[model samples]
Each structure stands twice: as structure tokens, then as C-alpha cells.
Target: MANPAVMVLGATGRIGRLLQLCPPQGLHLRLQARRAQAGNSTGDWHIFDPRAEPAALARAAEGAAVLLCLAGPVPGRGGADADMADHVRLGEAAVRAGASAGARVLLASSAAVYGARGGLLAEDAALRPASAYGAAKAQMEARAAALGAELGVPVCSLRIGNIAGLDAALGGWRPGFTLDRFAGGRTPRRSYIGARTLAEVLAALLAAPVLPPVLNLAQPGAVEMGALLQAAGRPFAVRAAPAAAIPEVALDAARLQALLPAPLAAADPVQMAAEWALLEPEMAER
Candidate 1:
């Protein structure tokens, strides 16, 4: 018997880089990107754009048991109609390719879908997106789920929280960075997951027998921005929070917790910082 083959779309991005740095064992990984890069490893590499070459996805997913779609617009990408449509088409392609086999599709979604709604959000919480990016992701989840059901393909949308080194507060830090302090003198708090932990979670999901249509991906607890900065020994200034500042955006992981084999311990800022430190050398080279 062979290990499950997993096709990773958007293999040149942040999470992809993290996975490449510390990939899971016992899985045959096939990495796909929009084009060939100058310095990426040459193993199991496929070059094609899912947006322009949507039809090619069927061929790319052949014999793969999992199609992980990490290819989506970033914050500055505008998340236009065309950009959001790319996810739907990619999901369609995944379903089309997996129709014959018992393959499953995992679409990368974001907590942005929760928008301005503060507090611990659940999978069933009503979406109230405030930014264009959030709106686009919310739309993607709906369209992908609907299409997956219609085509009899098992689809799961991972509503991921802030990744350790990929978030604005920590990763985007610079000298004289400013943070918003709310009325109670508390800095913003958000659910965060370590990059290595994220990889483990994904690998676990791939090996699971059943999956929910929608699942929130994050460590057990939320961390304060101040604590994270202190953990990293980064300096920043504090400013009064604006009216639009959201104090917290946490995801309730009860449903997700029930699915995992062991408990995912609550997020620790020091631990998250340490995990990100392991990938800093590679990040600097990029």
C-alpha cells in the first residue's frame, strides 16, 4: 500500500513555504505553483495557473487523494470578482478530478469571513464581513460548498485564523509600529496557530476518515497582541483605538477539537514565536 497522495495548490506562498520547510511525514506531496520559481526545490513541481488554466486542474489532481487549495487572493490582491471566482473554479476542478476516486477537497478559507463580529465565533455564526477581502472569502465558501454538494464531492472549507509569522501584528512588525489600545487599555486579541502546528493539523485532517463541510482552524486560545510582541522582544507604540477597531476576533474550536485525536493545546505567544523563528532564515532568503 502507498501513502496518500496530496496535491498542494499555491505551493509558493506563505503557508506553502512553511509546509515545505517542515512537511509532514508519510505523505506523498505534489507541489503546484503558478509558474516555476528561480530558487524553489524541483521535487514534484507542477506549473500552471488555476485561474487561466482551470481545465488543467483535472489532470493535475489525477490519482491524488487530497486537493488542498491554498491558492487565493491576499489582502492587497483586491479580492475582485475574478479573483474570488478563481477559488470556485478551482473547487470545481478538484471535484471534477476527484469524482471517480474517493478524493476529498480542502479549500483554504479565513476568519475574515466573520468580519466585524467580535468575540468567539462558531462555524454557524452569521457572516458580516467588513472588508472586500472578507466579502470575497465569504462568497468563496458559499459557492464552493454549493458546487461541491451538487457534484457529490466531499468539500471542507478551513476557516483558518492568524498564522504565527504570516500575520500583520507580528510578521509585519517594523520600528515604530503602532498598535491600537482599546478603552480598557487592552490591545487587540486574536486566535493564532503556530506554523508547525498548522502543518500537523492539516496532515491529521488528511488522514481522518470523515470531515465537516466547514471547520475553524486554530490553536485552542486567543493571544493578546502585546503578549506576542513581548514574547518576540519587538518594540511598538500604542495609540488609542479607533471606533472601527475590533477588540477581539476569536474562533470557538469545540467542533474542531472533537474531530482531532488529541487536544490542541491553547496558543502560547512564546511558543508561537519560537516556531516562527525556525523559519526565519528561509523567509529572509525570499
Candidate 2:
């Protein structure tokens, strides 16, 4: 049998670049970038502008078995309202293109859709998004699901958790990003997945014969912010602070684990931090 043809939108984003780095075997990749770049020489490249040229999106999705919509407005580049609107628009376009091509659509969604909800949030949790970004994701998922049903195409929304990359996690902080704290003076717990693990899970999902309507893509266990910071060689400051009612955002990824071929081990924050420490210098030079 010929390798399955996979069309990937948002091929220049962080998740898209990771997919490029370790592409799945036995699959033909078709990558779509918003603008043409001179140096990229991998896969079938298409200059797709979902908003400006919907026809281009349909053309790129032709004869594909799976369409992964990883497209979204770059974070922190635009106002929250504008970005959210763009996400909804892009999602609608992606669903239309994939449905027209008779392909299963995978929407890369976010756990933020649950918003300020504490404990193990399952796929069926009510979406009460606390922020604009979270609300946007919720809207995207809803639109995709409705479009897929209307067009008779299978759609899966992967509600991904924190993609704690080497630098992003170890650097302690970044502009426009904040860590959550619980009311009891403890660091808020969050479900997190390493970048490599995230890529692997995505590959597995692409290959699965059956997919759930929604799945939480997170590691088995939650990580404490204090533990993670300490593991990254940073001081844990909120240890003695007064506790607030901040919600601990932990996802229950049991459904995802059941679909994978092998069982997933719980993530080790300290080990992950150590690995990132070693690779930080190397990543900086590139």
C-alpha cells in the first residue's frame, strides 16, 4: 500500500516545526506555509492563506487521508480579541478544506478551554473559558465539530496541555507568561507534556484507525510549579506565601493513553529540567 498522504496547515509554527524535525515514517507530508520561504526544501510546499484564499486551502488538502490544522495567529503578536477571531476563522477554513477532500481533521486545541478549572479535567468538562485566548479555542473546537458533522467528516480535537520546551520551562519566566499559584501557598499543579512526547503522541494519533471526538493530550501526572522551578535551578519563592483560590489545571489523559500502543509513563519534572539544562546552551547557538 502507498504511504498515507498527510496535509499539514501552519507548517511554520512551533508544533509544525517539531513535526518536520521527526516526521512519521510511511507517510507523505504536504506542508502549507502562509508565505513562501526560499530555504525550505522539504515536502510538498503550498503557500496557503486561509483567510485570503480559501480555494488555496482546498487545493492543498486534495487527496489527503488526514489534515492537521495547527494554524493560529502568532501568540503575543496581536490583541487577544483579534487573535481569537483569527483562530475561529482559520479553524472554519481548515474544516471546510478537509471535509471537501474527504479527510479526517485533527484540530490542535488547548486545555485552556477548561479555564481556571481545578483537578483532572476530562474531555467532557464544560468549557467556561476565563480568558479571551481560551474562549477562542473553545469557539474553534465547536465550529470544527459542527462543520465536520455537517460535512460527514471525522473531526478530532486534541486539547493539548503545556508544551514545556527546554528553554520555556527552564528559563523561569518569559514576557506575557505567568505561573499559577494556589490559595494554600503551594505552587499550582498543571498537566504538562514534553515536546518530544507531544510529537510522539501526535504521530500515534495520526496513525490510529479510530479517534475519540476529544482527547486531552497531556502526560500521565501533574507537575508542581515550585518543583519544576527548583528542578530548573531557580529558587522556589511562594513556599510561605498565603494561599489563594487559584485553580490547578490538571488534565486527565486516560483516553489518550488507551489509544496509544504503549503505556505512557508519568513525566519527571526534575529529569526533564536536567535534560533541558544540558541542551539550553546548544539550543542557544542555533
Candidate 3:
């Protein structure tokens, strides 16, 4: 099949940039930025300020088949109320516009959205979002699913676990940081996927002609903090800080692997970790 025109709502985010670096198989990446985020640009562009109107979304998403949302500074994410509002508004608008455009929506979710889990987490795991950011993501997933079902559109919710790579560099996870502390050697146990790996997964999902209501996008194995840090070639503590509340997340890689060109990405914490650290920096930094 020919590539699809995909409009990424959070085109400027860490994940979005990675997607830009090596876009999925069928994506004509169109960026959706707020008026403020949109200063100077050339090429196909769509201006969207979730705070303003959902109508603007349709214009931005015109002729697009897939809608990928990576927008807004979510609540409890080191931002002001206005920032939080942007997140909520963005979700609603994207849902509405996605349905209107008859587009498949990919809602980027986090395992953190599942709240505190005693063991490995799955797609059906109960969501007890401990933080406001998790709550927002949970809401977004629910709304996306509901809206898709109610309409003819299909939505894919990737309940991701801790993500390594550049998102870590951007401090996307803090206060309740996942990969860092894990990589730091603190919070000894953690599970995560590298940024490029995540981009590849999202690409596969977007490529699927049909999407299930929800899916889990994470590695098959969960590694310890010490190993993660060592893999990344960073220095960290063996155990997490006293206040840290870590959840053991389980990601079913079978589906993710099925879409891959070959074998699944590395599952060993040390090796996979090293791939991102030793190999990534030396080879694939861009």
C-alpha cells in the first residue's frame, strides 16, 4: 500500500521528533502545532491551538488517514493550569477531528496510566492513575476508544511502559520518573523501550489496516535499575529513592513482533540498554 498522510498532533514532542527522524512505513508526517508553537514553517502545515477550537483540527487533518496525538503539557507534568488545559482540549479536539476525518487515531498511552500495579501489567490491567498526568492519558484513551466505536473510526491506545532514549533526555518522566531512576540504578526494577523502538512500534500500529480498541506497547522483558543505567552507560543508584512508587509493567511483544521486518528488538536489559547507550550514541544518535 502507498504511504498514508499522517498528521501528528504532538509533532514537536520528543517522540514526535523521533518519528520524524525515521517515520513509520506509511506516513506522510504533517505537523500540528499551536499558534504559538507555529512560528515559521514551510511545507504542508495545520495550525491547532486546542484551547481555541476543534474546528481548526479538521482543517489541519484534511485528507489524512491517521491521526497521531503527542500534544500538550499534561497536568502534574511540571506545567501550569493553562498547560493542563491544553492537554484536555487537545484530546477532545483530536478525537472529534479524527472521527470527522474518518481517520484512525493512535492515542499515545503510558503504563503509568495504569497506576500502581503489584505485578506485570497487561492491556486489561486496572487503571488506578496515581498522578494527574496518568489520569489525563487514561481519559484520552477512554475517549478515543468510545469515540471511535460510536463513530466508524478505529482507535489504537498504546499503553506504553517506561520509555528510554531521548524522551528521557527531555525529562518527559520526572517527579514520578520511570526510565531515569531505573537507568540510574535507583528503583532497581523497571521495564521500558527505546525511543526509536517506540517510533517503530507506533509506525506498525499506524500501518495496520485495522486497529484493535487497545494494545500494549512495551518490551517483553523488565530489567532492573542498575542494569538499565549500566546499559545506558550512566551512573545511578541500585535502589530508588524512598518516595518512589514503582510498578512492574508487562508488555505483550507478540503483536509488536508480528509487525516487525525480522526478529523482535533486544529484550535483555543489559544488551538492549547497551544498544541504546553504546551503539546509539556511536551510531544512531540522529
Candidate 4:
């Protein structure tokens, strides 16, 4: 088959959702839309919520060769405070669905899976998950890895970073994601990756020849806050905050590089900020 069929669980996310709508050359797409998103009549919308639409998902996975697990809470509406059953449910659902269809599962793990502290995390660094969210992801990874080992099925869990691009509260970051905030002149540093780059990474993960259930999927750069303001045609004192000092961690993406020719890994925050400032002219408005 020229295009490998893939089911995306979180097809409404910044990355997975975009791929379902505009799939690459080798992917024939199927998306898992939740109950509320049933009205989303875009793309090849499949009414499948990993948490509830298992039957629809099973059908969608039929004959598909890859499963991209990307669904998660958007902050508040999360799992029960007692257990991360929600995360476990999705992981289990995807594994079952993929095993039935003879497909590989690509799980969307997170950089947060590391912890809320600062450190340069390698692919195999010891996990020190801080938040309930991080702990849940750790549990999810265990499930994915076990499935991959026992079933001889490949599973890739990517620890993603601050996904940039639209949908982010900060839009049109032509001044850059952090820079746009600093344009107001005095903002904290942030980590970011272009949405397209993130989408590309997800696409590559499902197709990678070898599946590593745990991998870092972030651009290699620290988003400097001051640099961001400069790009917005505004000058502000910038500071490099310790990434590990923040909850949203920074990542080393050499692992992402070996996966595909997705060279956008170089779109570091510094480069992005500099390029933006160079390309766009400042308004004289004070």
C-alpha cells in the first residue's frame, strides 16, 4: 500500500489533529473525535473517543498499520484525583485496538514526564515525575512498553515539549512565542516548538523503523524571554531561565533527529526570535 493507514487518538490536538486533516504521503488517516467533537465535520472524522468510543475505534483500526495515541486533558478537566485511570484507559484502549488490527502504537508521552525540576534530560534519564500529570504519563508509558515487549508490537512514546504554533494562547508568534509576551516588555522565558515541526515529529514517530516507547520530541533550544521581545520589534531585558527551574522542561532532540530528516530541529527559540526580528519591521507606535 502506498499509504499506511493510521488511527490518531487525540486527533483534535495541536499536532495529531492537524495530521489527520492533512496527512502526509505515506499515511491514510483516521481520527478519534470525542462526543463533544462529533460535530467537527472536518477531515475523515471517526466518532471514537479512546475513553468511550472503543467500538468505533476498533472499526477504524481495522487494517491500519499504525496507532498514534495523542489524547489528553487540557489542564482542568482531568482524571479523578484518586487515580490516573483516565490515562491508563487510553493507553489500554490503544494497545487493544492496535493489537486487534496488527498495528504499531505511537503514544504521546510528555517532557513533563521528567519532572518539574531543571535538568538536561537524555532519552534514558531516570524519571522523577512531579505532577499528577507526569505520574500518569509514567504509568501510561509502562503500559505501552509492556505491550511492545510482550506482544512483539512496536510502541513509541514521545516526550513532547512546549508545542508552539496556533492554538497556543499566544497566537501569530511572528515576534516568537516568548518574544510576543516580552513585547509587553518583561516576561518569563518559555520553551516552544513550531506546530508544523511537532506534527512532522508525530508523523515520523509512527513510521520510524525502530520503535522506542520513550523519546524526547522537542526542538533543541531554550526560548529566551528577552529575545522574544526583540523579535516583536520591542526591546526588553531578557534572561535565560533554568529550564529545569520550570514545570515545562527543555529537551535535547538528537533522538528526534535520528527519527527523520525533520531538520526543523534547528528552529530553536533563539534562532526563531532572531529570525523574526530580522524579518519583521517594528512599528513606530510607542
lDDT on C-alpha atoms for all candidate structures: 0.83, 0.77, 0.65, 0.65
List, residue by residue over 127-161, the lDDT tens digit for candidate 1: 99887668777888887788778778888889999
The whole-model C-alpha lDDT of candidate 3 against the native structure comes to 0.65
- The Cα error of candidate 4 at residue 40, in Å, is 3.1
Looking at model 2, residue 60 earns an lDDT score of: 82
User: What TM-scores do the predictions have?
Assistant: 0.94, 0.87, 0.80, 0.76
Clashing pairs in 2: 183-243, 183-244, 184-243
- lDDT (Cα, tens digit) per residue for candidate 4, span 1-286: 3588888888766565456433666777877767545436756667656677777778889998898887876444453554455777788788888888989888877776778656667888878887778888988898878876777777778787765433232234333233222233435444566555555666676666676667887677656544444453443333444443453356777766776764655545545544334322321110
Q: Is candidate 1 or candidate 2 better by TM-score?
A: 1
Clashes of each: 0, 3, 7, 9
lDDT of 2 by residue, 54-95 (tens): 888888888999999888864464555455677788888888
- Stretches of candidate 2 off by over 4 Å are 79-81, 166-184, 234-245, 274-286
Task: List clashing residue pairs in candidate 4.
Answer: 11-17, 117-244, 118-244, 157-213, 173-176, 179-228, 179-229, 182-185, 226-238
- Candidate number of the best lDDT: 1
- What candidate 3 gets wrong by more than 4 Å, as runs, is 36-43, 74-88, 167-186, 238-240, 258-263, 270-286
Give the worst 10-residue stretch by lDDT in candidate 4.
277-286
Q: What is the TM-score of candidate 4?
A: 0.76
Better of 1 and 2 by lDDT: 1
Q: Which residue window of length 10 is worst by lDDT in model 1?
A: 76-85
